[model samples]
Target: MSYINPVLPGTNPDPSVCRVGSTFYLATSSFEYFPGVPLYRSDDLVSWEQIGHCFNRESQLDLSDTDTSGGIYAPTLRYHDGTFYLVTTDVGGQGNVLLTAADPAGEWSEPTQLDVPGFDPDLFFDGDTAYLSYAHGPTLAETTIKQATVNPDTGDVGEPSELWRGIEGTFAEAPHLYRVDGTYYLLTAEGGTHLNHMVVAARSDDPTGPFEACPTNPILSHRGHPMQSIKATGHGDLVDAPDGTWWLVFLGIRQQGGHPGWHQLGRETFLAPVEWVDGWPVVNGGELITPRMTVDSLPGDGSAPDRAAPARATLATFDDETLDVAFEHRRNPDESAYSLTEPPGSLTLRGRTESLGDSGATFVGRRQAHFDCRIDTRFTFDPAEGAEAGLALVADERHHYEIGVTRIDGTTVAIVRLRIGDATETVVETPVDGPEHSVRVDATAEEYRLSYLQGDKDYPEAVGTASSKYLSTEVTGNFTGVYIGPYATTGEDATSPASFDYFTYEPTADE
Candidate 1:
């Protein structure tokens, strides 16, 4: 179904959708946020529910010190012979590995290494033999496509085989290979992954072609459309409806606030109908207002919210499973490092040496959803040794906003400031009576003011503020989403416990 905005907002890109019977599952490429890839489920593609994560535990892929925008790239999701599989490139350094599961709801198998070169791999299984479609080298730099036969049963590649390169213009990265009837179709993204992006398709009778471009190339796009809803559209996947109808799911940006182009939600999944006209797929041809389409014959039979997010005032006591859409680390996530079965109700985040600037702490945060939002958290110190919990909007270490909580001589004080590149804003410190303190901040499209509630009382204590000063795609550009997570900078003594009662995100309830 066509969604008003991002059904799952904030920095979710390179979305890979797969249908298992009536159930639909989606996974996105998470660079730097460890646990590698996150898996989501939906009965109706419109309202999505995050079930469980694929890399909930370690052993899937190795992640450590991989900087923001490092590690994983575009990943492919496919269902073959009763098993669900995800194959991806370690764009940070190591190349490829394939992980599988009996069911998307179950614990995925340990990642199986694949001997292949290139990043942004998409998997297509025509039969028992599976094919991985990828753009090696640098997608923009290479402007090429490659394929290899992988045994679905073993998750191993036959050999590294070369496919056709993009001789024609507007045929670059995000290569997806589709076989229709007796012909093979290779769909790709061009003009980069932003505004100028377009979907181009080529075909050949052979899987390894001498492929020919379709007459109506760039089958779908909003290149010069009148509507401001769609821009930077590309990196898509195709799937068949239960009734045999053909549709395509691609990423698009919907501007929020008065800003109509730059997006906080990196790329959202958008759908358009495709009809095979003369052996070629046609996507929203010659249309200025590319309308949002639907798959169901009738809308939901009442009783369900039209994509309503649960009402939230504070982050603690949150019950939506707290899905970490962009949580990844150097090694696989250790369930024990942080326990889901915490003090019965609260989220217990163990103090880890996950360095601040050099690396980062284990974190899971949603993409920034609005021009303004607030983040609040409560954590205690270990008397002699206190931990640092940073509430931030991070693109990387270079550009970030950090408000740290630590113990000074046994009393708790809060320090908040803006740190950009090498410059700095005077760190503001507020004294509190208890060792545990409640911190809150007001962040706007233009301003970010950090303040704390004195001893759980909601009022302005000694405050610190910064003009959303570090907010600029040009200054800290990584085509990424902003996040709110807890960190530990308590030197060594890693055993010091840091329990974040809860972390809250408020996207401006009213004007």
Candidate 2:
């Protein structure tokens, strides 16, 4: 069977996985997005469908004051007995939280605050004894993998002790422990999370151990291959399939052009094969990970090409009463600002005083999973003097590209705005005839083109273009990818609301 890399694309970083019988469950960090951790289910390990979010309610997650990429960190998903447990760190709010559910796709229990120190929390069960592993310390130089016995139900934790410090690398974190054949193995990611990132392993007779480093350390890395398409290969978790094969699901970013070029889609979740040699694990037969792979066997039939039941082409008319699981808001949104039945068939956004530059804005976006994709939407907005509503491609609060219509001097105008670093500028502005207009943004490996359709025009005219590198993590110094969707803001003096007719996201063939 053959499948593509990045089984989970877009901003799906810090992937953690576990299996139950023939089914596999995975979860990833959501950062500042409202729904904290995104959960997925896969039968073949190649195709995955987003089942639900662990933190779907406002009470469960609060990102109201979080900076870009400052809310939820790495999450570990594991199944113990008949219940599924998800443990993660809320970077800026609650320290650490553990949540459980009987059904992986159903509603989860409320957060059980754990007294664990550090982020990237993982839970390992060995015959009713629950052990927790996490990265601890204030600075990267002092960072180490710490393990502790914890009561998963009562949120009580024992004192944590240092495990392995990795094989002489900085930021030794993202630890996952496993017991195979009476041997305890601790795998970790080191060398930060950029081009220098790598995966290392250690083994011992016990979980908390004076462990010995693997003979072949730094088992998986693309650091030395500076120009490789895949870089920063680390933060991995291992799952034993029912077919008696071991698989590794990790996080990696795809580089576009030059050495350490740029990746705007964020760190994606990738899959590779694992094999045991002697007493340690070897990844991909000692080969570097690439964009595609062909394996001997997968869990189920190799017929899962359309991963999440909605791939390539996505259209939402807001006909349903609630938003789809794919749509996410920035932080804890004012739920009253968004509605689907206000006008019966359209999605309406009641403009807030907060702009895209602030948290809690009236905005909803989907991840830009593919490098070459287009997002199109049509909306009607009669701005109250300074009000504006339209589409945007956002990286964070201070970095994004927007195309919308706003009233200027009693005339409706279509405008394209670009925000990079600390500078904000209006690149294009044209007078329009009515309140309704169509806008779209086309993304390529190198740049993003924002366009708008004029009256009686068959095709959208290009309004402006921006280099994709400006939105990358290297440039923005953040841990999030870009999101494309609709937004509305009143800008303090206006009170008009915006109504969107429909939205579409389609991936195009890369050039």
Candidate 3:
């Protein structure tokens, strides 16, 4: 009953796990992935369900014209004192913003920006003083670690002082500071976040001081790839299991080919045991843990190891809402920008701007990765002449591809095109599948292939090489993640508004 693969499927990266009581909560930095800061709750660290999102409205975080990597970056979710704090760096030129809520499942407060200079921030609270530990931008030569006091009331960062810088080019990023048994332990992600990624630790008597690196520097690493289920292991947060055992949860990439960068399987969440031997934390035999078929222990409910269909996975079920976690924005969107209630299950993506480059369309997208996926759309493409209703593999304005029913002339035409940055290349153009018809876009990732669904089957006989290349965190400039979404575009060429009867995304059960 486990997901067996991709629990947080399709570009759910930068996962930060926080266990509130017996309920385990996980949040990922949803760069342009809208409804920013996706929050999922699971009784067990495994089996999870999407309870809500952090940015519920546009006013909180804007996403209009936001390029590929423009939105939110690495976020740290922590339960301090009594409130749940979700801190993130909005690379969208908005600086860093922190939002808080009394309950993880309740309404969250608006984000308060910090004049801070770095990204991927983690907060530490001690008594009345709060410290924010983060390091991203270039260091003073060594890896830079900055520590600053955070205001509890406004979530504003105070004057920051330079903490220790790692000697290696690798900086102390994703730093988590905690005090245990009279010592301040700083747990940080080292070796960068890419290839050499690993969890490193150091301890200091003071919150800010000359720290001593752990003898076992890399407390955890996924370097061993006998079958390499977790790759690029780093950026971790520590937690105490219900049984009182200490553990660390971190994100790692799972690569298929040793060649690297064929198809980024993705950065997945992984947990490892932490042994505190003589004040130094040793993780999984002093090396990163290898992937396992299943976690041995049960989750909070004490359920058996997953006979449940999908653990910690987000399921839309064509429900009342479009599974908020599965959405993103051009610029930040206001509640009025889109609607899930009007047609209920049918997501009506109102057009924000006209041009394809900057227009804010309510594109409910998922990551474009699948050995096989079936996405059927019953959309009414009756908008102004140029408005578009189609499914897209959106990386950015520059790098994107889509096949959809666009209202052309007096009728709807099926258009296929590829856009990489400012330049666009049209794959082909066909007159409609017929007016107001059911069009589906099916993409298979095996050979990095994609195709359009013509009727009940993969459509029009066009299969493009399936590549997750454009979706790479390296190529696409935006901090935002890429998604495969069904979009409705409105421009000056439009006549009336279009509404979709429904859009269903169901990957092959085994995919």
Residue-by-residue lDDT tens digits, candidate 2, 1-511: 5667888888999999999988999999999997768889988887788888999998888788888889899999999889999999999789789999999899998899998778888899998799999998889666888989999989899988988777884698889999999999999999889888888989999888989999888889988898788899999999988878899999999978686598999999999999999989999998999777777767776555433323535689888887767788888878778889878788998878888888777899988899899899988778877788999889988899899888888887888999998999998888877777889898899999988875676433438899999998888999999988899988663378788999999888732
- Provide the TM-score for each candidate, comma-separated: 0.84, 0.96, 0.85
Worst 10 residues of 2 by lDDT: 304-313
Off by over 4 Å in 1: 137-140, 159-161, 167-171, 223-229, 254-262, 285-344, 349-355, 360-364, 370-372, 382-387, 408-411, 442-447, 455-461, 465-473, 506-511
Best by lDDT: 2
Error of 1 at 508 (Å): 3.8
Q: Rate the local accuracy (lDDT) of all candidates.
A: 0.64, 0.86, 0.65
Cα lDDT tens digits for candidate 1, 195-284: 677777889887767789888767866676535666777777776666566666677765544443344445656655566889888874
Give Cα distance to truth, residue 501, candidate 2, Å. 1.4
RMSD of 2: 2.0
Of 2 and 3, the candidate ranking higher by lDDT: 2
Pairs clashing within candidate 2: none
